[model samples]
Each structure stands twice: as C-alpha cells, then as structure tokens.
Target: MLRRGMILVFSVLLLLSGSMTVFAAGKTGEGATPSGIPLAGLEAFVDNYVKEYIGQKTVGASVVMVKDGQVVLSKGYGFADVEQQIPVSPDTVMEWGSISKLAVWTSVIQLAEQGKLDLNQDIRSYLPPDFLTRLKYSEPVTMLNLMNHNAGFEEYMFDMAYQSPEEVQSLEAGLRLAQPAQIFRPGEVVAYSNYGNSLAAYIVELISGQPYHDYVQEHIFEPLGMQDSIAYSVVEDRPELLEHKAKGYFFEEEGSFTQGSWNYMSMYPNGGNNGTAEDLAKFAMAFMPAAGEQSPLFEKPETLENMLARSYSTAEGMPGIAHGFWEYPGTLRTLGHGGNTIAFATNLQIVPEDRFAVIIMTNQAGESNIVHGLTKEIVGMRELTETVDLPDTSEVQGEFMAARRPGYGFMKLFPYLTLMKLKPQGENQLQVSLAGMTGSYQQVEPYLYQKVGGDSALDVWPMLYAKMGDGKVEAISVYTSDYLPLPAGRTMPVLIINAVLAVLAVAYFIISPFVLLVQAVLKKRRASRHSVSGAGSRRLVTCLSLTGTGIVANNLILALRMLSNNERAYSEVYPQLVINYVLTGLAVLFVAALLISWTSKRSALTVRDKRAAILPIVMIAVLAGLLVFWQFYS
Candidate 1:
C-alpha cells in the first residue's frame, strides 16, 4: 500500500513540474516575465493571479501588501460565506493561525525593551516553581532559546486546543494540561516548537500580571488601531465575532468544499488570532525600519533589528530562523512565517531590505500554494547562491529519521515515522523517499539539492546536509512549501536489523501455531522427531496465540475508533497505553513458555527448530526492551 502511494505521488510531482514549465512558456507580452516587473506592474499581475488562484483553490482569501511602510493594497477574493453568498472584503475576519506568533514575539520584544525581562534569563524564573518538566540537562532555557526554537522541548500534541468554549481552559490551566517533556538540552538544535513559544507567552503573562490575550490586545492590537481585530486566548469565547469571521473549509471528496469546525487554542498566544487583512498589515508595517514614531510596535528600531537577526542555527552553514520569522535563504534576505490549521492556511513575508511585507490568508486547507505563488509574483524569488560542486554520491546514501520526532511519546515506534531513504540515482542526483512519497533531487552545490522532480516538486527550497567531524553527513534538512525546515538524524544499520527481527518474530507467532496444529493432527504425533506434543508445547502455543490475537484486536479497535470519532478520539488519553501493558504481559508469558519448552525433555526440539526459536526469542526480548525504552511498560 505504501509503495503504491509513493508511486502515485511521484507521478503527480512529475506532472506538476512539467506543467509549470509549460505554463511559464505559454506566457507572452509585457507581463510574460515576472522578473524586473515594477511595483505598479506587480499589483495588476498579483490581482489576476490571486483571482485565478482563488477560483482554483479556496472559498476565499484576504490579501494585504505593504510597500515602503505603507499599505498599498488590502482586498479579499471570492466569498467569505458561500452559503450566505457574502463576498469577502479587506475587513473580513480570518483565522491567522500560527501567524499569531508574530504578535507574541512582538510582545516579547516590547517587554525586553522596557527592561522588565531579560532575553538571556532562565524562563523558569518567570513561571511558578516546577512549571516545566525537569530534564537531566541543567542548562536553563532562556527567552532567546525559545524565540530561536532551540529550547529543546518535545512537541506536545494533546489538549493543544478544544472544539468548544466549555472545553477550553485558562492559560495557566492549559499550560499545565499541555506541558511537554524537555528532551533535548537547551540550545542543542533548532526544533521548531509551538510549545516553546506558548511557554514564552506564559512567561509574559507571569511577569506582566496580565493574561496573554489581554496583554497582546492592550499593547499590540489596540496600539496599532486594528479595530477589526481581536486576539483570543480561547477562540470559542468570541461567539460575538462569528458574524464577521469567514468559515473555514477543506477540500473534500470530488474536490468539493466541506466546512470544518473552528478549534480554539487555550494558548492563544501561539496561534489564536482572528483578524482582517488590513489590520494584520498594520501589525506587519510596525516592523519596518521606516516606521519611526508612526509605528504602533513599542519596540525601538534597534530592538526590531535584533529580532530579525539570525538567533540560532542547528548547523553553521544552514540558514537559521530569526526570533519569530523563519529565514528563507536566497540572494535576498527574506524572513517570514507560514501557518496552517485543519481548514485554513496563511503566510506572512517581510523583506526588511526592500521595506516591504506581504500577508496572504486563506480559508482553505493545503492552499499554501496560492500564498507562495502570489508572494513570489509580487516580490521575485531570487536563486540560492550556489557555492560548490556536488561531492561523491556514495557519501550521502543512507537512512535518516526526522530530528523532530512525532510527539506522541511511545508512538514514535509507529510506522508513520517519516524516515528518509536516500538512494543514489547517478552523479549529483538522488532519489529521496519519505512517508510514502518519492522524489528525485539534483545537487546544486556541495551539500544542497534542488528537488528537480517529485510529488514534493513544489518544495523549491534547496535541501541541505551538514557533516560531522568524521566527514560523514550527520543530518539532512528538507522543507516543504509551508512546513518549517525539518532536520533528520542519520541512523546506522543495527537499527534496521532490530526492526526486521521484530517483524519476523511477530510473523512467526502469527503462522507457526496453525502449521504445527495441522502437522500434529495429520501425523498423530509430534511435528518433528525431537519435538513433543505435550504440556510444554501446548503452553508455548497458547502464549503465542494470546499475544498475536491481542495485538490484532487492539489495533483493530483503535482503527475503528479513529474512523468513527475522528478528532474526538484524540481528545482522550492515548489508547495505546492499555495495549502496551497487555503486550508486555503476553511477551513475558511467551518468554517463560519458551524457557519451559527448552528445559523439558518431553518438548526437546531439533537443532534447526532451536535455531529458528532463537530469532523469535530475541525478537520478543527486543520488543520487551522497547516497551521499557518508550516508558510504555513502566
């Protein structure tokens, strides 16, 4: 099934890359070329592109462009509420998603400027004692660390948001509910963390003696005169704003739009802003160096500059993120952040050098393609400066796992882990497979690859690899159109061997019992000359049958629950914990049964059978160890 999915995705990528090239060639006349187009010309070009993009992709979108620290255009495309036939306008309220992080960071800068907080001070200082889970590492997480996404907290997945107002908790309560395990040491790697930002916001709340939502509303939104905007700590609490807000939708079966429920984040500081494009433009404009006294942002020019500087990088040569904005490495210095929910996608870009910024918000899922296209048309994307030729392809062929593992605790062992398999295609070329998606990339420079063809063809960003002291590649980073760049760690062969052994052990349990039963019944004797059909054999078979049946039943129940309840299924504690305990008990019994069968003379096994048993025994032991490793059995 996975192989077929990969093939279909790869085919689509080829079609897209081919179509894009053909579409570019089809263009003619003065507007044919996007490059060197003046700002005046860009407005018309963008207007047409956005209209076509909206017709093709979304129910509606709100776009705002700022040039020279002034709003040049703020307009909406398509219908805000399709059922009501209401056309969207610049004033239409839209969910800004993670773009809300901008305001949160701005608040941090404001506090720092006031000398009310120190950027380098331990964040735990601002919170109540034991606010965060303590790890072995003693290095304190600082404001600087959180802003740069190096605070090292694992992604927290549960209780992140609620579907209804009643389910929503206060910021303090929410933080406690979603408290993440700090797995990495401070400043170790730039794992983009939403929890880290929310923690920072909680710190803001602690120091200012103001609720996170209230502080941002009082300082950032109100000061900017964004009358149409409201920052909500809990999205459901704003039932009054529903009349002005666009309904979120997703492309469903047959490319039809399906309305999705609005989810309210308890930590609204991270991604809970609902506002108009014009209002967000005002917020974006505040970051411009040209704003001077006119800027609504309380941070000084020097402070804003500091906010835009590259704060932390996982690798030396890789383009690192700024305090809040992610760095889009190119010939031009572009800092921006893109955001998504189940039913909405949005992007905001700031080219400080050009004194320009663009915010594109859409009421549709997976519609970031529109945001990327329109932004590039307005502000031409420059080529990444190629530095060196590709080295030997053999050096890069291996497996890698995402550095930011899925946050579901023991769920990391799930097959859904986005592992990367890189196979050399030829000189300077490679085939990359991840999460059932396959693509081919050509090395553009020493360690950078341009995704020339694949389902990920839209990922125009060059892939980067960093090497260790041994001259072997340590990790590789890949970026999708809207996702933060993900660095995947290298893995050795031993892990693969263990995984294979575990699968074989499970397979043996599944089929061997039936085979032995048929042999014993037909021959009216033991299956082998040295084997016995006595108490020891019966005990071993019983243990194997129980373990195999339990695993199947647990997974089937989980699959059914997901199919029926969807999001509601995730709201509860992980169901896998119950299964993990059962598996552990069954594994213990299986090992004990094997030991009894081995020692009993009546169940004496042939050398070949004993050798076969060793694999399954080792596999069971490995499973037991993993249960402990992931804290499922403990």
Candidate 2:
C-alpha cells in the first residue's frame, strides 16, 4: 500500500511538471501592449510562426523546447504520411542519421575509459589484418581522425548507382571498395566521410568481438534507457510501435517523385539509425554531468567535455565539427548534428551551459530552412522575414558578366552535362543558360532571384535566395536539373536501336533450332562415313560455342561491376547497360558449351576439348584482373 501511494505521487508530479511547461510556454508572450513583450507572447509567436511557415510547406515536424533543464514546449505538427493521413506525434520514430555518430563516439570513449581502446593510437592496431594492408597511407589513422572526420576517405554511398544493398559484392568487399586514398595527410583537414565512420564501426566490432549495432545497444542505448532507438537497417519483428516511420521520397525527374528504397542496409553506423524525440531528449540528458548517476552511459564529466569540444573544422569552410556535432562560435554556444536522407531531415542541438536542447525532425528535404528559422525565433533571436529589395541592375549585370568571362566560366561532362552562360533577360532580370537550356531570373532582393526555366513543366522553381551580404553575389547553381523532352527527330534513333537488338535476339533464337535440326539430319546421314559430326555441324557447334563464351565473359564483368560499385559499365557509353549484356552472354555461353560438348567425340577428344577451353580460360583471367582492379584501384 505504501509503494502504491508513492507511485501515485510520482505520476502526479510528472503530470504537474508537464502541465507547467505547457502553461509557461503558452503564457510567455501574453498581454504586451507596449514596453516589452511578455514571455508568453514570444512563445506564442514562435509556435504560430512554425505552424504557419512549416505547415504550408507540407512538412511533418516535431519540436521540443527546453528551458532551465526542463521541457517548456514539446509539440508535433503536420502528418507523417500525407497520403495515408497519419499525423505525427512526439512518439514518432524518425531516422537520426548522422546523429547516431554521437552514440557511437560515446561507445568509443567508454572503451577508452576501460583502457581497451586508445583514441590517440593508430586505429590499424585495433583493425583486422586484411584491412590494415588494404589502406593506402603508410601512417596509421587514429580514432581522433575518425571522430573529427579527418580521415581521408571518400563518401562511398553518394552515387545513385550504389543505392541498392544487393549490388555490393559483400559487406567486407564493399568496405574495401569504398576505401579512399589519403587526399592530404591524416589530421591535415577535416573531410567528412561516411566510409570512414563505417571503418570505425568495423574497428569497434574488431575490438569488441561483437557487431557494431549490438555493441552500441549494450553500451549506450540500454544504459541510457533509450528504449525506442534502434540501429539502421535492422529488421524488427514489430516496427509499427516505433511510429513516425516516415517514408522517404526523391524527385526522380525534376518534379516527378518516386519512393526511395531503404538504401543504408549495407552500412548502418554512418547515417542510418532511428529513434523517438523523447528518447533522444533522454539521450541529451545524459550529457548533463549532474545527471551522471541517473544516466546509464557515461559517469565522467570529461567525456561530455571531450565530445562537446570543437575537434576540427570542415575543409569546405563550414563551421567547426565537434565529435559528432557542429559547433557554432558565439556567446550562445551550440553543438549538434544535422541529418539528411531522401525524404527526412533532422537537427539535434544541445546548449549544455543553458541546460537547453532542441530536436527538430521533418519529413521534407528543404524544411531545414524552416527548422533553422524557427529555432532562432524560439531562442529570441532575430526573425527571418521574406524581404524584397531590388539590387542595382548595373552591379547585378557586372557580376553576371564577370561570371561569364573566359577562365571564370567553365563546363564539364562526366557525371552529367553542364554548361553556364550569362546574359541580360529584361530590365531587372538576368538570364543564365546551362546545357543549351535557359532560365530567366528577376531580382527580388539583393542577391536573391525568382528563377524560372524551360525544362520540366511541373518542376518547382522556387526563389533562389543567397546568404551573401553586400559582397559580390555568389553564382547561383541548381543542385538538381529539370528533366527535358528529347526532340521529335531523336525518337527514331532510339526506336531503331531497340528494334535492331530485338530482331538480332529473335533471329539468333530462331536460327539456332534450325541449325541444330540440320546438323542432326546431316550427322545421321554421315554416321557410316565418319565417327565425328559433319563439317557443317562442327561449324554450327563452334559458332554457338564461341558466342556462348563471349556472353559469359561479358556477364561476369558486368556482375562484378554492379557488385563492387553498385553500377553496370560497358565501356563508357552506358555504364548500366552491361547488366543486360552480361545476362545475354551467360545464356549464350551455356547453350554453346552444351552444343559443342555433345557434338565432340566424348572419350577420344578430351585433349582437343581442353585446348578448345582456352577462350574461357582467358575470360576467367580477365575477370580475375577486373576483380583485383575493383578491389585495389577502382
């Protein structure tokens, strides 16, 4: 009876605390005619602004405002799925992406605390033997480099070709393929590499003799009581309770949308984890040294300090990166990480000194601006308004001309075709042409333009707003291109190519049976004359055999490319077309080998058959060479 009473009291206290937070948040900006605005008024303004601004963008978002180490305003807005009509709530499980880096980093520090791992020592000491020899650099990379993103490794999963897990040869092989050459030297410049984080996870696995996800779960999640969190790519038996599992979508062709597949199954630690907002709040609470005993993760204050400190700055001239967060230099210090997947974008921030934190998760790609704007407004910073002011046409025109001048303007083709040109469109608008395409821009504000272009008719041409102040305007470039319809004249060539390929395949299939029948008839007639098949039959057999050999060789090459790089390549024309070529080659090779063996003298021609297998032998050698190239060079 006494324990029941205590439980009731505890529940009441929690209820009271939640009510007070809501009340304080609501009353912040109330009843302010003059002098200074009430705190309630400010809070109301922030809430209303987020609803008004972010809501119109069709973004599903959750915001938590904490003050004095207490949640003041925690609310969810919009829908998790617009089509399904599922509303978002605070309990919604959103992908934390790179924010999981913090949890992994914490585990590393814990290992260090236990004297099992050293942050300053060479990481190769902890890694497997095979991985050590595969690295390009002589100097070993350290844990610090991985934590601060100083390890020279390219982002392996950025390409669209590598979006499927099945395309990779194997987890280990994929890691080998993703390894990057040291661009500068270790600790020279901070370059964020998803591949580097993956390697770190591998190292952790090597040291702990456990899977990366399992290690983090045992050390970080379980200790912190983050019950709702799980590593990325994990297939849970019951995923519905996790809630707010927002589906990711990408613009396939400008405005045309397509659902993106779960692309992070091959590597989870880098940017593929999911959790609830409140659970993350609990995770942030672990950073408070005062909550040391209550927190399950870390007991030392130095761990928090080390993780929050600005470890390095990005080489691309961005703000400094902390252990797993970005540091903003100011009196009001902030540390956090921003995550972006196909459909969702999230930001987790903590201002430990102020005992405040913010978690903003959205289901839209461009909702980051809204999240940033709302965060500043809630924190009583300057309001971001849509200001309209025309720039001096002469200045705008001059800047445009400078961008178009020789040595200043350039074009490149490899990944895609791109070209840039600058010319005047109207009195106040300047036109920039790219890839034989044109876009008209009207100056709405200084360094801001409302751009419209000819390409996809349904494409969204939102206003391009530059952050440059009074200095020269930075050149505006679109990250995604608008899809274009080919000219009427170009359709015939495509159709002709398809027709030719189809006819050839049909003819080959149709002629093969006839050839076999003719050979059978001739062989039966010549059975008494010779023990071996007729010359015509042998010629048909050889043709089929050679064709089959060519097909298999081509297919093996294609499959390897797809597995190693998540892409198909046939020379350089269409890298993805080799998948089909490979399939055709394999089919032809099997049939040819069968036909040739059937026609040859089974017992007497073993040596001759061995010699005939030279083509396949060479093909295997080439395949082996390609595999080696993919592992080490590609």
Candidate 3:
C-alpha cells in the first residue's frame, strides 16, 4: 500500500512540473523586459513578476519590503487554500522555521544587555549537573562560543533529540549526552551548530529561571508589540488565536502542494515559533530604531550594535554569525536566517545600516529559495518611487474541503473514521466540537478562514477547511510538529538501539587513545630489535604508520559522530529537519572512511601491522553496526 502511494505521489509530481513549465511559458509576455534598467524599471519588473508570475502560482506567500525604515511594499500573493480559492493576506500567520532562532537570540541578548547574563560565562555555570554531564571538554563553553558556532558540537544532535522521544529521554537526558570531546578549541573557527543554539537557549532558561518561551515573550516579543507571535507548541490547542494562521503546504514533488504534518515540539526557542508577516515587519522595524526615541525592547545603541556585529564566518566564505542573526558581507550587510519544516519555509532579512529589511513567509515547502530571490529583487527595486498594485481575488468562491473521496464509499467510512464532529451554523460558518473542544469558523471570503466565536474552549481556533468535491473536506494546514512523542504505553526499540550505539561510541573514544599509546611504546621496543634499513622493518613501519593514521582518523570521526548524535537527541525537541539530514550524511561519511581504511589493510602483513589495522577496523565495524541499528531496527 505504501509503495502504491509512493507511485501515485510521483505521478502527480510529474504532472505538476509539466503544468508549471506550460504556465510559465504562457505568461512569458505579461511584463516588459527592460534593458539597462533604472530603479523605476526594476520596480515595474518586480511588481509584474510577483503579480503575474508568482502570485498566480498555486501556493500562498507574503512579502514585505522596507527601505530606510519605511515599508516600500507589503503584499500577499496566491491562495492560502487553493481549493477554496482563498487569497493570501499580509496578516496571515506563518511558521517561520529557523527564523525563530533570531527571536531566541534576541531574548538572550536582552538579558545580556541588562547585565543579567554574560556572553563570556560558561554555559555549564547556568545549566544543571545532568545537562553539564553531556558536554565534552574540561574547559567551559562560553555563550560566545554558542552564538558563533565555534563550540564544535554536531548540528544533527539537536534535531534528532527534538524528533525522537527515545533518543532524548528528557531535556536533561539530551544534555547529559552532549559531554563528548571537543572538535576544536573554543573561539577557533566557526561551524554551524543547531545544538549550540539549543544549548544556549537552555542556558538562558537556567539563568533566568523561566521557561524558555516565557522569557522571550515577556522580554522581547511583548515589548516589541508582537502580540500575534507565540512559541509554536504553546498555541496548538488554542485554535481561536490561530484564526489567521496560514495553512502550510509541502510539495508531493517540486512546486506541487500537498497536506503536510504540523511540527509540535518543546524546543520552541530554537526554531519552533510562529507569527504574522505584519508582526514580523514590526520586529524588523525595531532593528532600525527611529530618530528620537529608543526601542522599548532594546534601548541602547551598543546593544543593537553588538547584536548586528558579525561574530563568525560561515563555510560559504560569507560573514556567517552575528549575535542572534546571520551576516552577509557587502555594503548592504544583510542579517537573517531561513527556516524550513516539512510544510513551511520562511526568511526575515534586515539591513540595519540602511534601515531596510524584508520579511517573507511562505506556506509552501521548497519555496524559500525562490522567495529569497524575489525578496532581493524587490529590495533592489525599492530605490524606485513607483507603485505596483496588488492583484484582485474577488471572484474566487466555494467551501474549503479537506479531502477527496470516491462518492458514497467515503460517506460509509466517515462515521467510523471522523475524529471531530462539525456542523454548519450559518452562512460560511462552522461549529466544530472535538475531543470535548468546541470552536466556530467563519469564511471571510477569497479563501481566508477566520474564527468568530465569542466563547470557545480553545484560546485560538484557526480551522479552515476546503471542500474537495464529492462530499469530502480537507482541514486547513498549519505548522508541522517536529516529532510527536510516542504514546506512553508503546515500547520504542529504536531508542534502545540508539542508547546502545551511544554507549559503544563513548567506549571507543575512551579506549582508542590508550590503545594508540601502547602501540607506540611497542613500536619503539621493536625498533631496537632490527636495523631500521631492513625491508622487513620498513614493511613493519609502513604497516604501523598506516594503522596509526587510520586509528586517529577513525577516532576523530567517532568523536564527531558522538557529538552530532548528542545534538540530534536534543534537536528532537525542535522543528528543524535540515539538522537530521546533516546528521545522517555525517554518519555515512564516518562509516565510509573507516571501511576504506580497513579494506586497504587486507593484504599479507606482519603481526605488528595486523594489530595496527585490527583496532581501527573493529572500531569502524562497531560504529557501523550501531548506526545501522539506530537507523533501521532502532
């Protein structure tokens, strides 16, 4: 059945791609091609492209461009729900993936500015003993290391922990696993570490003695008047507050929309947060303080300057890390982070020096790259003093449904499968009662779904459904959950295997150094037995050298894997998926390197040569087994 579904998904993808090509070809002549473009021409070009090209595309998106502290253009494009023909709006709330990192960083910096926290202080000083146990080095890891990504922690560890319950027994359990060896000394070169950010959040929570979400809301969000924004998992049960929440979509294939899961996890500070594009604009504006008064949230010039300063370089040879944001080198000096989950992708770029910024939120996955391109284009065009009218969406009509069924066949099964009871209360209004929860939804026209109930069980009820014809309705989409914790009663074998692998990895790191030292001593003793120029002695030396190099390489790889795995354990608490992929890729690379070294030693060799080869080979095999176990059977 899964295979059939896979085939069906692939077929739909091909159709969508083919259709997009045809559509793009048909609209090729809708705008003028300007040669030797001026700012006016650029503005005209961008407006036409967004409205005629991107706006007509299937997915929903919001774009806001600011220049010199003023909003030059802010518009919504496409349908929040295509089946209901709902047009996107600037007020639509979106799950802005990793962009949430900036929010976390902002809150932390606020504490630092208040002299309540210190960037140079060791994180272990703030965290509990259990959390401290997971760290690798004897020396302290400072807040600066965490912010600059110089802590040498694995990016995948945090992601995995956020997604898999068994991988991370608790927040404390995940932290305990972080105590591996450091990849590099603190304040060396920068490496992107989601785990580092997550740990930073944990440190903030420890120091403030507040829940991570509460600290950010009280200090940063509320002060900025970003009332619409909330930590992602906190608002799940309150559909009313989420009435304007935009539906998130994932591509069955490239450029095709399909329902995707909502990411609900406890790691809200790291990357699990949601807000409206308008609110995001306000947040960006705060970065550019007005002439007379200071920002209510951050009143100091030095505070703002420190936040925007480039702290580290990224692998791309660009200025990578700022205090709580990313910096790109150029006259513009943009700072931002792009976020993605299964369903949504978002970006918030700020040019503090020019007092310009762009906030882009898209319901569609895989659309962030395109949105970033469009944002850059719009920013360049803002120099022009031209107006571009938004497209109208008054003609779209109909009820939004959740699914399509084969006529009577679905009605027969509906009673058995339907988890929520829904009834139509008035024109374009629905009263939904589910799991002892009741809420109302009113169709606001052109595909927007709004909750209008005066009294409801949910604090925020943002349910939008699209009628898919033939008596089936699809629920409106929202944020995707990172990894739903398994039911308490269910046993997770995969977690057990991961724990075992983690133990073995620890054992290898602990024992490999001692083994290498003993081998070195033995080699010195053997050197005295024969002339160093003999062919036999030369072969022995060659074998020993290769073996030593392989061992060192294997141990280095294991150490990295261990640290990354620890990060994955915590990442299960967040909603980012990129970290998981990175972790998997690194695990594969580690194993491959070990295998290559092992294969190179299979030829005829002396006892000393074999011993050198055997240790690394054994370590590699154990690590491979562990990874396989964790990936599949675990």
Clash count list over all predictions: 0, 15, 56
CA RMSD of all predictions: 8.5, 13.5, 23.5
Which digits, one per residue and each the tens of the lDDT, describe model 2 over residues 1-634?
9999997675433322211224333434443311133445544554566554333443467666554444555666655655564556667677776677777777787788778888889987886676745455677689888887766553333221235445534335556654554543676534466666777777777788887888987887888687877865442423664444765544344223444544344556766677777677767767753544433565666766776777764222223567656653222566666666546677676766666666777666535444554544333221123555566544533211111111110010111123344456776676756556566766655555555444321122223333332664333322111111222432446435544543454344345556657756876876544335334334434555445444444444644654444422122324334443453455456546545655666434344444544543344344333323223112
Please give, for residues 1-634, the per-residue lDDT of candidate 3 as tens digits: 9999997675444322211111122223332211222323434444455543343343767766555555555666666665554556766677777787777788778889989889988876777665644345566788887777667553333333243222223333334454333544565434455556667777777778886777877877788788888855434545754776767675554345666545544455566677877688878888888666576668587788778877754232223567767653323566777777546777777777666676778887656334655554433311212223411222122222112111121121221222344556665556655445666755444333344553332312222323223433323321110011222322246445555665665576466667657856787778644334233433433343343344334434544554333333433322222333344455445445434544564433345544544554455456545534333111
- Per-model lDDT: 0.65, 0.53, 0.53
Segments in model 2 whose C-alpha atoms lie over 4 Å from true places: 1-43, 132-134, 158-174, 235-244, 250-263, 291-295, 314-318, 378-634
- lDDT for model 1 comes to 0.65
lDDT score of residue 65 within candidate 1:
71
Lowest summed lDDT window (length 10), candidate 2: 406-415
TM-score of every candidate: 0.77, 0.56, 0.53
TM accuracy, model 2? 0.56
Candidate 3 Cα deviation (angstroms), residue 589: 31
The candidate 1 region of ten consecutive residues with least summed lDDT is: 17-26
